[model samples]
Target chain A: MKKTKYRSQSGNAFLVAVSAVILGLIGGAVLMAAIGSNPFMGFYYLFRGGLMNIERIGNTLATATTLMLVGLSVAFAFKTGLFNIGASGQMLIGGLCATLVAHKVFLPRPLFLVVLVASALIGGALWGVIPGFLKARFNVHEVVATIMMNWIAYWSIYYFVPAYLKGPSLETESASIAISQSLRAPWLTKLFNGSYINYGFFIAIVCVIIIRFVLDKTTLGFGLKAVGSNRWCAEYAGIKVNRNVVISMMIAGGLAGLAGLTFYTGYSRNMQIGVMPAQGFDGIAVALLGASNPLGVLFSSLFFGILQSGKGFMNAMTSVPPEIADSIIAVIIYFTATSVLFQRFWDRIARRRGSRRADQREEE
Target chain B: MWSTLSSIFPYAIAYTIPLLITALGGLYSERSGVTNLGLEGLMLVGYFACAITIRLLQDTMAHSVWLLTLGLVASVVAGALFSLLHAFASINLQADQVISGTAINMLAGALTVYLARLISGSGNVRIRMGIIRKNIPFLSKIPIIGPLFFTQTYWTTWVVLAIWALSWLLLYKTSFGLRLRACGEHPSAVASAGVNVHRMRYFGVVMSGALAGLGGGVILITYSGEFHGTVAGLGFLSIAALIFGQWKPLGILGATFFFGSATTIANVSQVIPSLSVVPPVIFKIFPYVATLAALVLFSKKSAAPKASGQPF
Candidate 1:
C-alpha cells in the first residue's frame, strides 16, 4: 500500500507537468492568434525548423549538449535543496580555464582533452564551492551569494579575455581555439556530416548516467536528498547537512563547468565577454520541468534545445516573430515551475476518489 | 579637489535613485515574510511597460513630463499586477520562492520583449525626451552641497528621495508597519493575534511591485534613456542593496548611495587621469566586489525578519 501510494504520487507529479506544458502551448497559441498569426503554422514551422535537416539536427544536439549539463547541474543542486543560480558564472569560469588550457597547454591529443576537461571541472567547482561554503559557514542565502558571484565572474571575464586571449583585430572575443584542441574531432564531424556535434554530447550522456547512479544508488546521494528534504531532521539523522551542501554545490558546479567546456570549446570554439550564458538560467526551467530527475532533465534539455534552435527558423519561415518563441518558452517555464499547485489539485482529487471507492466497497 | 568630488555627486545621486527605490521595494516584501527574488524581474517588467507607454503617449500627451509621469504610474500598476504571479506561486501554490522568482524574472523579460516585437516591430521600445532635469531657482544657489545635488536635473532623484522619506515613515511610524513587521518575524503569532498573515504578505508583495516598477521606469527615463530587452543586471544590484542594507529602508538608501558612488567612479574614472592607472574593468568590478564583501560581513549578523521566504 505504501509502494502504491508512492507510485501514485510520482504519477501525479508527471501528470501535473504534462498539464502545465499543455497550458503553456494553449496560452502561446492564443497569444499568436491575438497577434494575427496562425498558431498551427507557427508550431509546424517551429518543429520542422529544428528537425528538417541533418545539420539542423546536429546544431540542435550541440545546443542540447550544453543545456543538458547545465540542467543536470541545476537538477542536482535542486535535489539537494540548493538553488545554484550561479551556473552561468561557473560555466564562465570553467570555460575560461579550458580556454586558457587550449591556448597554453600542449600535450598529446587525448591527454590535452583530459586536461581541458579537468580544468573546467575544477574551475566550475571553485565557483560553486564559494557560495556553498558561505551558505554553510555563514548561513548566507545561496541565491544572493550566487547572484553576486555571477557579476564577479562576468567582470573577471570582461577583464581576462581581452588581456589574455584577444583575437586578431577583434576586441570583443578570444582567438578561436584550434579545432584540434577543441572537442570537435574529424571522425565525429564526418559522421554528423560536418555538423557542430562534438565530444560534449557523449560527455553529457555519461554525466547524466553517473548522476542518476549517484542520486539513486549512493549513500552520498541519500544524505544530500535527506538534507534537502529537511536540514534539521537530517542533522538529527546524523547527516552533516553543511558538508552535504558543499558537496552538492561542488558536484553541481562541476556539471555546469562541463557545460562551459562543451559550449566554448566544442560548440563555439571561442569565448566572448560581456554576455551571461542564457543556458545557466534556462537550465533552471529545464530542471523544474523535469521534476529535478536526472533522466527527466536529460529529456527536457533536448526538448528545450529544439525550441531554442527552432525559434530563429520559425521567425524566418512564418509571420510569427523571434521574440514570440522566447515568450512561448518563458510561458512554458512559468507554468511548469508553478506546477506544485497542480500537484496539490491532483492530490485532492486522488484522495477524494480513494475515499469514494472505500465508501462504495462498504456499501457493497 | 572638493569640486571634483562634487562633480561626481549628482551623478552618484542619479545612479542611486533606482537602486534605492528597488531595494526599498524589496524591503517591503521581505519584511512581510516573502523572499522576493522577483524584484529583478519586476523592475524589468516595470521598465518595459514604462518605455512602451511613454512611446505611445509621446504624441498624444502635450508635455513630456506628463507623459513620463503617466509612464511611471503605468509601470507601478503593471509591476504590481505582474508580482501577483510570485505572490500566487509562493503563497497559494507553496512553490519554492527562488524558483517562483526565477520564473517571474524569465517571464517578464521574454513577455515584454515579445510584446514589444508584436507591437513595435522591434524588440526595443525607445523615447528621446521623457527624461528631464530641472533646477529650483532658490534651492540651486545654496552652498557646496547645493551645486553637487541640484545640478544635472533629473526629477526622479528628488521624487525618489520623497518616496524614501515616506516609505521610512510608513515602515517605522505606522500601525500597518508594525503588523507587517510582525508578520515577517512571526506569522503564526500574527495570525494568533487576529491579524491575517496572507493579507499582510499580499500587501507587502504588491507594494514592492509598485515601488520597484517606479524604480524601473525611473531608470528608463533617467539613466538608460531608452528601453532595451534587458535591465543589464541593475535589478540584481538592487537585490544586493536590499541585503546589504539588512532589509531596512534607511540602510538600503545608504547602501544604494555607496553602490552609486562606486558606479559613478567607474563611469568617470576614464576621464580622471590619476585614477586611470587601473584598467577600466577593475572599476567595473568594484561594485560587485564590494557587494560580496558586504554580504559576507553582514550574513551572520543579519537581523532579517525570521519568517522570510516562508510559505505562510
Candidate 2:
C-alpha cells in the first residue's frame, strides 16, 4: 500500500507537469489568435522548422547542448538552494577565457582542449564563488549579488574582447581561435552537413549523467540537499552549510562555463562585443521547467532548443513572428511555477469527493 | 579637458537620470523583499508606451507640453500594470520570485518589441522632439555646478532628484516606511502587529514599476531621443546600480551618477587627447568594474533585510 501510494504521488506530479504544458500550449494558441495568425498552422510550421529537416535538427541539437549545460548549472545551484542568476555573466567570462586559451596558448590539440575547458570552468567558478562567499559569510543576498556580477561580467567581457583581443581591424570581436578547426569532430561535421554540431553534445550528455549520479549517489549531494531543505538541520547534523553552498555554486559555475565551450569551440569561435546572449536566462527557465533535476534539464533544454529552432520555421511559413515561441515559454514558466498551487487545489477537490462518496456508502 | 568635460556634462547628467530613477524604483521593491529584477522589462514597456503616447498626440497636442506630461503618466501606469503580473505571480501565487521575474522580463521584452513593430509599422520607432529642452535661466549661471548640474540639465533631471528626495523621505522618515521595512525584514512579525505584509509588498512593487516607467520616459525624451530594441539592456545596468547602492535611495543616486559618468566618459573619450590614448572600451568597463569592486567590498560588510528572498 505504501509503494502504491508513492507511485500515485509520482503519477500525480507527472500529470501536473503535463497539464501545465497543455495550459501553456493553449495560452500560446490564444496569443497566436490574438495576433491574427492561425494557431494550428503556426504550431505546424514550428515543428516543421525545428525537426523536419536534418540541418534544422542539427541546429536544434547544437543549441540544446549549450542550453543543457546552462540548465544543469542552474539546477545544481537550485538543488543547493542557491539562485545563480549570474550564469549569463559566468558563461560569457568562461567563453572569453576559453577563447583566449585556445588562441594564445600553444599546446597539443588534446591538451589545448583540456586547458581551455579548465580555464572556462575555473573562470565561471570564480565568478559564482563571489556570491556564494558573500551569502555564506556576510549574509548577503545571492540574488542581488549574482545579478550585479552578471552585469560586471558582461561589461568586463565587452571591454576585454574589443580592447585586448580584437582582430587587426580593431572591430568589436576577437579573431577565431587557432584550434577552432581542430576542435570539430569529423562525424558531427558530416552529420550536420557542415553545421557546427560537434562532440560537445556528447560531453553535455556525459555531464548530465555524472550530475545525476552525483546528486543521487554521493554523500556530498545529500549534504547539499540537506542544507538546501533546511540549513539549521544540516548544521545540527554536522554538515558545513557554508561549504556546501560554496561548493554547489562552484559546480554550477563550472557547468555554465562548459556551456561557453560549446559556443566558442563549436559555434561562434570568436568573442563578440555588445551581445549578451539569452542562454543563461533561458537556462533558468529550463531548470525550473525540469524541476531542477539533471536528467530533467536535458530533456527540457532540448524542448526549448526545438522551440527556438521551430520559431524560425514559424516565421518562414507564416506571418507569425518567432516571438510567439517566447510567449509560449513565458506561459509555460508561469504555469509551472504555479503548479504547486494547482496540485493543492486538486488534492482538496479529490478529498472532498472521496468524503462525499464515503458518506453515500454509509447511508446505503 | 575643459571643453571635453563641458561637452559631456549634459549627456552625463541625462544618462544618469534613467539609472537613478530606475534604481530608486528597485529600492522600493527590494525594501519590501521583492527583488525587482524585471526592471528591464518594465522600462521597455515604459519606453514604448511613452514614445507611442507622445507620437499619437504629436499633432493634436503638439502645442501643449502637457502632452509630454500625459505621456509620462501613461508610461508609469503602463509600467505599473506590467509589473502587476510579476507581483501577482511572485507575491500572491508564491511562485519562485526569480523565475516569475524572469518570465516577466521575457514577456515584457517580447510585448514591447511586438508592440513597437505594430505601432511604428517598422522595426524601430523615432519620436520628434517638440521643445523638449530649455535653459534653466538662473540655475544655469551657477559656475562649475551650473553646467554640470543646472544649465544643461534636462527637466527630467530635476524630476529625478525630486523623486529621489521624495522617496528618501517616504522610505526613511515615515510610519509607512517602518511598516514597509518591517515587511521586508520580518513579514510575519509585521503581520502580527496588524500590518498587512502583502499589501505593502504590492505597493512596493507597483511604486517600483512607476519609477522605472518614469526612468524609461526620461530616457526617451532626454538621451536616446527615440526608442528601439537596443534600449533593453540599460535596465539591467540600473539594477546593478541598485545593488551597488546597497538598496538605499540616496546611495543609489550616487551610484547612478558614478555609472553615468563612466558612461559619459566612455562616449567622449575620443575627444580628449590624453584619455584618447586609452582604449574607449576600457572606459566602458568603468561602471562594470566599479560595480564588481563595490559588490566585493560591500559583500563583506553589507547586511540585507532579514527576510529577504523569503516568500511571505
Candidate 3:
C-alpha cells in the first residue's frame, strides 16, 4: 500500500505536468488556426526551430542557462512557502555585481571567474535577504515589497549602466565583458559549434542536484519545507520559522543572481537599462510548470527556452506573428499555473474508473 | 514659493486621481478576502479597451467630452469582464490567489500587445487628446484655493473623487459592505450568517476590476494621451497606498496624494533648482523607495483582512 501510494504520487505529478503541456499545445494550435495558419506546420517549425541543427540546439541550451537558474530560484522559495517575486531585482543586482567585477577586477582566468560568480551570488543574496528580513521582522508582504524592489533595480540600472559603465558609443547598455572574463568557456563553446552555450548550464545542473538533495535529504531542507508546509506547526516543533524563511529567500535570491551573472556576462553579454529581465517573471511560470521541483524546473525551463528561442524562427517561417507565439506561451503558462483545476479533473476520472472496477469485482 | 507649490499641486492631484481609483479598487477585493494582485492586469485591460474605443470614435465623434465619458464606461466594463477570470480561478478552482493574479497580469500584458499589433499595426495605442483643462466658473474666482483646487482639473478628477465618496458610503454605511468585509475577515462566520461568501467575494473582486479599469481610463485620458500596453506599475503602487491607508477611504486619498507628489517631483524635478542636481532616475526611484518604506513602516500597524488570500 505504501509503495502504491508513492508510485501514485509520482505518477500523478508526471501526469499533471504532461497534461498541462498538452493543453498548452492545443491552445497554441487553436491560436495558430485562428490566424489562418496550419497548426501542425506552426508547431513543426516551433520545435524544429529549437532543434533543427547543432547550432540551433546549442542556442536553445544557452537561452535555457539563465532560465534554469531563475526557475530553481523560484522553486526553492516555493518549497519554503515564500514567493520571491524579487528574483528580477536579485538578477539585476547579481548581474550588476558580476559586471562590476568583470570590468574592474583583474585576475587569472580561474580566479577571475570565481570572483565573478561569488560576487553575483552575494549581490543576489543581499537583494533577496532584505525582503525576507522585512517579512520576518516587520510583516511586510514580499509580493508588494518585491514589486517595489523590481522598479528600484530597473531604474538603478537605467542610471548606473549609462553613468559608469557606458559602452564606447551606446548609452542604453554597459560595456561588454571581455571574452576570457565571461562565463562562456572556450571548450564548451567549441563543443556547441559556435552556439552561445556557456558554463552557466553546468552551474544550473549542479544547483539542481544540490537543491534536490537539500530539499529531500538534509535537516536544513527538511526544516525549511516544514516551515513552509505549516509555519505554526513547525514553530511548535521548535523550528525557527522566520530564520528558515530568510535563509530560503537568501539562497533563492543568490541562485537568481547567478542567473543574472550568466545572462549579463554570458548569454546577452551586457545588461541593458529601461528593461527588467522578463526571465524573472518567466521563472514564476517555470516553477509552476515544474510543480516547484528542481528536476521539473530544469526540464520546464528548457521547454520555455526552446519556445522563446524558436519564436523568431517561427515568425520568419509562418504567417503567424511573433506576438502570437508569445500569447501562446502566456496561455500555456496560464493553464499550467492553474494545475489545481486539472488535478480535480483527473481525480474525478480516476474515481469513476475505480468505482466501475469495484462494481465488476463485487459481481464476480 | 507658493506659486511653485501651486504649480506642482495640480499635477499632484491629477496623478492622485488614478492612484486613488486603483487603490479603492484594490480595497474592494482585499476587503472581500481575495488578494487581487491582478489589479495591474485588470487596469491594463481596461486602459487598452478604452484607448482602442476612444481612438476608433475620435474619427466620428463631434464632441470630445462624449467620447471621453463613453471611453471611461468601456474601461469599467472591460475591467469587470477581465476580472471574472481571477474570480473564477480563486473562488472556484481554489488556485493560489497570488499565482492566479500574476498569471492574469502576464496574460493581460501579452494579450493586449498582441491584439493591439494585430488591430492597429503599431507597437502602441495612440489617442489624440489635448488636455481638456477646466476652470470651475464659480470656484475659480475664490483666491488661493480656487486655482489649485478648481482650475485646470479634468472631469476625471471629479469623477474619481465621487467614487471615493461612494466607496466610503458603501463600505461604512451599508449591509452589503458589512457582509463583504465580513467575508474577507471570516468567511465561515459570514456563511453561518446565511450570506454567500463566494458571491460576496466575487462582487468585491468585480468591483475592484471596475474601479481599476476606470483608473486605467483616467490615467490614459488625464495623465498621458496614449496606451503603451503597460500601466507603469501603478497597480502595485496603489497597493502600497492601500496598505498605508490602513484600508480606509480617506486614508487612501492621503496615501495616493503622497505617492502622486513623489511621481510629480520625479517628472518635473529638472525644473526645480534644488532637485536639478539629482538624476531624474533618482526622482523615478523616489515613489518605489517610498513604497518600500511605507510597507515597512505601516505593515505592522496595518490591519489586513484576516482571511485575505484564503479561498472560501
Candidate 4:
C-alpha cells in the first residue's frame, strides 16, 4: 500500500511535468503564429531536424551530454535548497582546466582521460565551495554569490584565454584541441558518421547513475535533503546543516564542471571567451521539468536537447527563428515554476475519481 | 590623472543612470517582499521595445526628441506588460519567486531576440538618431564640480536623476510607501490593517518593470544606439547594486555610481597611460567582489525584507 502510494505520487509529478511541457509547446505555437508563421510546419521541421538521420541523432545526444551534466548539477543543488546559477561560471573554469589539460598533458590515453576529468571536477568544486563557504559562515545568499563568481570567471577568462591559449587568428576563443586529446573516440565518431558525439555522453550517464545512488542510498544524501527541507530542523536532528550545504554545493559545482569539460573539450573542442554557456541557464529548466530527479533530469534534458539541436535546422527549413527553442524552454520553465496550478488541478481530479469509486463500492 | 578623471566623468555618469534606474526598480520589488531577479530580462524587453519603436518612427518623425520619448514610453509599456506574468505567478499561483524570476529573464531574452530577427532580419535594431550630449550653460563653468557633474551630459541623465529623486520621496514620504514597506516586512500585519498585500506587491513589481524599462531606454538613447537583444548583464549588475545599497534609494545612487566608474575605467584603461598599468581584470571584477564583501558585512544584520522571498 505504501509502495502504491509512492508510485501514485511519482505519477502525479510526471503529470505535472507533462502538463508543463504541453503548455510550453502551446506557448511556442502562439509565438510562432504571432510572427505570422504556420506553427504546424515550424514544429514539423523542428522535430524532423532533430531526428531526421543518424548524424542528427548523434548531434542530439552530444548536445544532451552537456545539458545532462548541468541538469544533474542543478538538480543536485536544488535537493539542498541552493540555487547554483553560477553553473555557467563553474563550467568556464572547469572547461578551462580541461582545456589546459588537453593542451599540455601528454599522457597515455587512459591516464590522460583521468587527469582531464579530475581537473574539471576539482576546478568546478573549488568554484562551488567559495559560495558554499560564504553561505555557511556569513549566511550570504548563494544566488548573488554565484552570480558574482560567474562574472569573476568571465573576466578572468576574457583575459586568460587571449593571454595564453589563443588560437593563431581568432582572439575571441581558445585554440582548438586535437582530436586525440579531446573527448572524442575514433570508433564512436565514425559510428556516428563524423558527428561530434564523444565519450562525454558515457561520462554523463555514469554521473546520472552515481548521483541516483548517492541520493537514494547514502547517509550524506539524507543529511543534505534534511538540511534542504528545513535547516533548523536538520540541525535539531543532529545533521550538520552548514557542512551539508557546502558539500552539496561542491558536488553540484563539480557536476557543472563536468558539463564544461564535455562542452568545451568534448563537443566544441575550443572555448569561446565571451559566450556565457546558455546550457547553464537551460539546466534550471531541465531540473524543473525533471522535478529535480536524476532519471527525470536525464529524460528532460534529452527533450530539450532535441529542441536545441533541431532549432537551427528548423530556422533554415522554415521562417521560424532558432530562438523559438529557447523561447519554448523559457515558457516551460515558467509553467514548471507555476506547477502548483497543475498540482491542484490533478489533485482535484484524483479526489473526484476516488469519490466516484467509493460510491460504486458502497452501492455494490 | 585629474585630466583622465575629468575626461571619463561624463561617460561614467551615462553608464550609471541606467544602472541607477534599474537598481531603483529592484529596490521597489524587494522592499515589497518580492525578490526580483528578472531585472535583466525586463531591461531587455524595454531596450528592445525602445529600439523597435525608434526604428519604426525615426523616419517619419521630424523631431528626434519626440521620437525618443515615444520609444521610451513603448519600452515602459512593454516591460510593465511582460512583468505581469511574473507578478501573476508569484502573487496568484504562490510560485517559487526565484524560479519565476529566472523564467522571466529567459523568456524576455529569447522572445525579444526572436521577434527582432523577424522584424529586422539581423537580430539587431540600429537607430539612425540619438540624443546629442550637451553641457548645461553656466552650470558647466562652475569650478571643479561643474566639470565633473554638469559638463557634457545627456538630458536623459538629468531626467533619470529626477526620477530617482522622485522615487526616494515616494518611497519614504508617502503613506502608501509605509504600507508597501509593511507588506515586505510583515504582510499578515499589513493584511490585518486592511492593506491588500498582493495589490501592493503587484504595484511594486509593475513599478520595477517600468523603471527598468526606462533604464533600458536611457541606455539606448544616451550611450548604446543599437539593440542587440541584450543589455549585457547590466540588469544583473543593477541587482548587485540593489543589494549593495541595502534596498535604499540614496544608497542605490552611490552604489550605481561606484559601479559605473569601475566599468568606465575598465573600458578606457588601455588608452589611459597611467591607468593602463593596472590590470583591466581588477576594475572588471571589483564591483562583483565588493558586492560579495558587502553581502558578508550585512548578513548578520541584514536589511533585506523578512518576507522578501517568502510566499504569503
Which candidate has the top score in DockQ? 4
* lDDT (tens digit, per residue) of candidate 1 on A203-307: 999999999999989999999988887778999999999999999999999999999999999999999988888889988877877778988888888888888
Pick the lDDT winner.
Answer: 4
Stretches of candidate 1 off by over 4 Å are A1-11, A355-364, B62-64
Chain B in candidate 3 has what TM-score? Answer: 0.95
What does candidate 4's lDDT look like per residue over A20-76, in tens digits?
Answer: 999999999999999889999999999988889998999999999999999999999
Error of 4 at B201 (Å): 0.3
Report how closely model 3 matches the true complex, as a DockQ value: 0.48
Per-chain TM-score of chain A in candidate 1 equals: 0.93
- What would the per-residue lDDT of candidate 3 be over residues A1-364, giving only the tens digit for each residue? 0000001124477777788778877877887887688999988888888989988898899888888899999889888878877899999999999999999999998888889999999999998988888888887877777777887888788888899999997899998888887888888888888888888888888999999999999999999889877788999999998999899989999999999998999898888887778789888878877878998999999998898888778878987666655666566666665667778889999999999999999999
| Stretches of candidate 2 exceeding 4 Å from the true structure | A1-13, A105-109, A167-170, A176-183, A352-364, B59-64, B120-122, B230-232, B277-303
For candidate 4, give the lDDT: 0.91
lDDT of each: 0.85, 0.79, 0.84, 0.91
Clashing pairs for predicted structure model 2, backbone only: none
Candidate 2 per-residue lDDT over residues B176-214, each given as its tens digit? 998998888888989999998999999999998998988
Per residue, candidate 3 scores C-alpha lDDT tens digits across B230-308 of 8877888888788778778888898889888887887888788866677778767777787678777766556788888
Model 2 residue A108 distance off true place after TM-score fit, in angstroms: 4.9
lDDT of 2: 0.79
TM-score, chain B, each candidate? 0.95, 0.95, 0.95, 0.98
For every model shown, what is its TM-score relative to the native structure? 0.95, 0.91, 0.94, 0.98
DockQ of each: 0.52, 0.41, 0.48, 0.59
Question: How close to the true structure is residue B307 of candidate 4, measured as C-alpha lDDT?
Answer: 82
How does candidate 4 fare on TM-score? 0.98
True contacts kept of 1: 0.60
Candidate 3 error regions (>4 Å): A1-11, B62-64, B277-282, B298-301
Better of 1 and 4 by DockQ: 4
